[model samples]
Target: MELNPWAVAGLVLVALVTYYLGHHSSRSATSTHDFLVARRTVRSRRNAAAISGEYLSAASFLGVAGIVLKDGADATWYPIGFTAGYLALMLFVAAPLRRSGAYTLPDFVEMRLGSLGLRRFATAFAVFIGILYMVPQLQGAGLTLGEIVPGAPAWAGAVVVTVLVGANVMFGGMRAITLVQAFQYWLKLFAIAVPTFVLCMVFFAGGGPAGMRSLGAPAPPVFPKDTTVSVKTNVTVKVNTETYFYAYGEIDDGPARGAAHWSPAVPHKVASGTTLKFAAGTPVPVVSDIPATNDTWLHPASGKITDLLQTYSLIFALFLGTMGLPHVLVRFYTNPDGRSARRTTVHVLLLLGLFYLFPTMLGALARMYVPQLLVTGDTDAAVLMLPSALLPGLPGQLLGAIVAAGAFAAFLSSSSGLLMSVAGVVFTDLLPGRIRDFRVATVLVALCPLALTFLVRTEDLSLSIGITFALAASTFSPLLLLGIWWRKLSWPGAMAGMIAGGGSVLAALIYDTVCGYTGTVPPWWTVQPALISVPAAFLVTYVVSRLTRSGRPELVNDIMLRLHAPDPLGLVQDRVVARFGQVDDKARTGRGRHRKA
Candidate 1:
């Protein structure tokens, strides 16, 4: 793809203005409220927009489309889980988390758990989750930039985005991020929606059903060749002895790649009627199991159990993890009161719905128009590839530019939010004894992830996301839910759950990394950790609370009343004067001395 100077120029202009707004907004902010929660003054609509913008990362824009393009209807789980997750947030997590009035999840932990040790553990967990989440955003930015600037390096793109994000977070904190993410959400929707509409027209005019068949005709029964494609699939433990795996990858040049192998049979108990085939003279390899359709679009493993695992894993992560997201949680504090927070969650759902519709459409378009991407082995690039391939001349260039800008925004918005959350935790909870330089705290947090991005790079945005989700589900989700709803929740149980749950997940992650276990890595590695760890946390808090019962039920009632009540926090008082009670006024006139009798 060729670079258009004008398009590049447009992107640069957006970047500059975004940075200016973020930097300028912070110059006046001096207090903790200004730095952490935008002084809790944002309205519902803006807060909602900012929340949606922050949550919709490169995965929503690019990874989901890419997954759908490569895997068909099964991939729809991405959007469904994402939207449904917010519903979960609105119902179970939103108001309670906001009402806690803690700056970060760790702060909430410290307050609820009442132990410096527990706070430190939660802080570390947060930093880990935040960094794990940051990597993919940086990678997504690099991928988008590489598409636009022909010769630009991935790290260069990463650097540009990191700097922009850091500057915004450093200067304005939550206030600046609110504006950026809110603006970015609309921009992202436009970038995807306009191109998607144009592509749909092209699809209909180009041949619709007929053109699809014609373009698809040359596609081999299994185009290219077939080999034992090494696909990373999720498996579960029904028992210890028997492990399950599914997913077949591309085989470039072999009998399996070219010839048929039915005798050996498909492993993992493929669907009863599933058929596998290979076409001749096809230049690339294709692997699919959708017997009737024979379209490469639906090649993923098929089974009731496997399907359930994937669905549940996605749902759990999406729903539970949203509450734990530092970025999302902090937004609640941006509102003036609980009502604004509740309203913000509602508006966020609407904005998220609007934006989600576009990416799903684009993913479908990519499957039809840009099947060639499967050959390049980068499905994640589908969002970028489809635009340039279909549109010629200026429209293509313009859309490409828009996408590039939007991608940068996604990275910047998400990164800034995560960095801000981490910074709050580090400064307040991690170093509670002393006040650190505010500037130093912000930079320290930002720099760590920026460094981590360079050290670990991946094309798999989904995998990166899963790592973060697993971490969040294990630690903060358990901590927050128990802390809020369960009055019996003891600080000991909170500490135990966070450590046990968080530690188990961390150990699994390490094993996955060191052992190179390249399966979907199993939902057990994900959901099991949360399911068990969360309970353990609750139990520990219970037992520990029983042992050291303060019996201060009134404290619990008081906190609840404050959180749920409709007062303006009642932390300030107004001065009043009455003219009728003014004997001092007569004394001031000097005739008052005579009136003292």
Candidate 2:
């Protein structure tokens, strides 16, 4: 079956209605504050939902399942690392950063260090990271639309999302995007949650193909039923336990695509637009890139040194990276105050943890039931295809539709936030800060990613997003953390560190993109740059800040007072939490001096 029309229609309908409502309710943004940070009036719960909506991008929505299906237990660590990054944010940066009262990261930089130069420097990093993140989201949209309407070109879905996102940000700015993103969070949750439940039930009832533990095994999968697999793209696969395979196009070392190709003992190229018919009991072939065995896939990095190094680097990148994401920090600015930001982060942690469980299940399910995807290199389509592969008839179609809708929601919510963030910065810092300038800024910031989506050729959704995180962690994380928590962090040090860290990751991104060096197998030490880049950033910041003090902002004391002090005069503090929980006379002055010591 190629392209489900009903599913496609439902997804487009959902996008149109959500955007219409957001456009309808757009708060006439009259100032830079309104466009950039929603006037800092968002409450905890609502802000939390919007944050989760954007944060759960295509990587979280669909890439997780594909990673799990392809890599097995070790890849489960990816979700843990992602979830932990938010926790690190809650404890280390959320409250104080919100308390800083800046609309954007660059705004915060200027406010903290009293340097227009550093702010502009930060603006550059924000733009780079934002475009990098958005490109993959657009690509994920292409992948999703292709799944919905097979043979659909890559540019179609990207253009659709770009138009919707542009309209929402252009008219309403943060306010409109917030509402749209919040709606998407629930839609995405429902999309995946319902399918996971029904799929689980079916597996238990029908007693799934072989054992469910076959994931990562090199052995070819035994087809449970005579299923006809379609090769949507060209791929090379080596047939395992050869049988009388009836397929179309050039096969057995010939180019992929066409009919009447027999399965040879050796590896052959399967062209696009080809159909491969296999007897239900035929053993499936393993593709070229991924491992062929269950043990390696199931227990990846099983005490191996390289895997361990790669895993730790990934963890560090994610852990520190959350604090630096331009879109994420923008959400904190929407909170009513520091306390509300903290509270919203708690909500985010719980929601993400609960949502990730379903992806793990789906990944395992795909590996067991849809192993043919390994040959086609469409593991990313696992979540989209699992429902129909498990349950047939109307029920499967409906669930499949839900998943497709959710995937589209993922693309919309994430790209919406990132675009708003990058655009807001451009409006405030690059161009004039007039309210109407936001529309122009939105167009300008979007062009890079939109062109990238169409021109550069997108790759794995999760991996590209990961590169951005590594870049952010390397560039801005140390700056944010040090600026907020350290009194001695000078503007010079911050600028130097930002350059050092961001420059390093930027080099890696360029090298990989230009040389085609980044792939399933990459050169040593370059796969995740956080290992070197993050530390280099921190160390540079510390050494420079300690050595040079000329650029320290004179207002550092005043900024610290605001960050650590209770809402002055109760004007900003008048919320549901009436009293200052910890700040009373002595705490207000300074949490009590180190007396006896």
Candidate 3:
């Protein structure tokens, strides 16, 4: 792919604008309270925009379309699950969590259960989930930059995003990025919505509704024109029909590999760095996991029993996981009151629903326009490549630039929020809760995930995010749901349930990684464990709480009332102030003594 000056300029423009907005807004963030929760002064609509902006990460921006391109009708569940999760959040968590007067998840854990040990344990999970969530945002950045400027090292974009996001968080914290994120939300919407409208017009003008009907055609997707595909990673592809193509590089590990005609009975392995050129009308050879024909792709639940199981697990993770995301939950703390938090969630649901419509449309369009992506398994690039593929010449490049900018904005906004949440947990739980410690924690949190981006290879962006959601669903979902509603919940039960849930997911992840290295396919449950893990977590929490009923906190009733009562009641005080009052006092005293000297 050739470099597009328009796309590069759009990326640079978005980055500069993000920095300026963050810098301008950060002026008021002089205290720890402002840094952590924006002084809890954000109103409903603006906070809703910021929350929506932060929630629509690279996975939503790029991976949803990519998955749609790969899986056809099956991909619809992702957006449904993602958007509906907010509905669940609004119903169960939004108001109650805001009324809890906790700045972070750990703060809530400690405040409700009155257990320092459980608080520390919850902190560990927060950091872990935050890091897991941040990884794909950085990887998506790399992918976007690479598409804009061909041949650029993937880490370059990751590093650029880390520096910008780290600077924003370290300097201004949540207050600074809140405005930036809100602004980016609209920009992203404009960027994606415009291109989608143009492409849909173009599609209809060329083929009309008859073209739409062809999506369910029995034949496999074919190249619209002569296309060249470069394999960045080794992949095994299944060719459903007899196809002849010109090959330059290793194919199937053959001794003499160049310019070969292929007949397909079994899967064929194409090594990385190989380039294949195919003529127009050639049926695309798709990665083994993808459906080889449009009919199969369009049909939902077309796979075996495992695919059905995986779909349910994916749904469970996404629906329950929203309430548990550390970054997402922290946004509620920025609301002025429980009412504002509830209103913000409603606004978020609407904004998210509007934005998701475009990606689902884009994904469907990609199957018709960008079939070459199937051959290389770079379906994540489907959204980035779609505008140019449908619209030719200058128009295509400009629209491509818009899509690229939106993709980058997705990376920036999401990464900033995740970094803030992780840094807050680190500062409050690990270090002293001083303003200076926030800066240090920001650096530490950003560096750990940035470094990991180098070591770990990028998978399907949405799939990776789904795993984190599963983990969150297993661990914190049970903790929050049980902690808030059940009077009998003990620290031991919360801890035990969290361990059972988190440990199961971790064990599955390890097994999956081992299978990847050994070139074996893991079970469906390992891929999406929420179906097993979520129920296990809830059951364990209930049973263990029953067994340990005698050890329940005496303040459970007060906490419960505080969580459920209306905002005017003021049933609870800010637990963060109570928990860290001594640290704050010591810092103040030290500063005063220094001034005296």
Q: By lDDT, who's the top model here?
A: 3
What tens digits encode model 1's per-residue C-alpha lDDT throughout 479-529?
777677777766666766677767776776666665444644444444324
> Each candidate's TM vs. the true structure?
0.79, 0.89, 0.95
Instruction: State the C-alpha lDDT per candidate.
Output: 0.63, 0.79, 0.89
* Per-residue alpha-carbon lDDT of candidate 3 for residues 220-315, written as tens digits (9 for 90 to 100): 888888888989998999898998988888888863255676667889988988989998778889999998898889889755898899999999
lDDT of 3 at 224: 84
Task: List residue ranges in candidate 3 displaced over 4 A.
Answer: 207-214, 255-257, 578-597
Local accuracy of candidate 2 as per-residue lDDT tens digits, 1-597: 556766887787888877886676474444455566765667777788899999999889888898787777777877898899999899988988887767788988887899998889899889889998899889998988888887788888898899988888888788777778877888888888999998999887865554333544566565666768777666777655545667766565555443343354566677777788776766666666565566666666657677778787888888898889999999998886788899999999988888898988999888888877776777888998888788766777888898999999999999999999999888878775666678899998878888988776555567778888899899889998898889999999998898888888878777767656333445435667788889999999999998888889887888777777765434232111111122123322242111110
- Tell me the lDDT of model 3 at 592: 14
By summed lDDT, the worst window of 10 consecutive residues in model 1 runs over 572-581
Which runs in model 2 stand beyond 4 Å of their true positions?
A: 27-30, 207-218, 227-277, 514-521, 568-597
Ranked candidates (lDDT, high to low): 3, 2, 1
Candidate 3 C-alpha error for residue 416, in Å: 0.5
What is the TM-score (0 to 1) of candidate 3? 0.95
For candidate 1, what's the RMSD?
A: 10.5
Candidate 2 lDDT score relative to the true structure: 0.79
Per-residue lDDT value at 412 in model 3 = 97
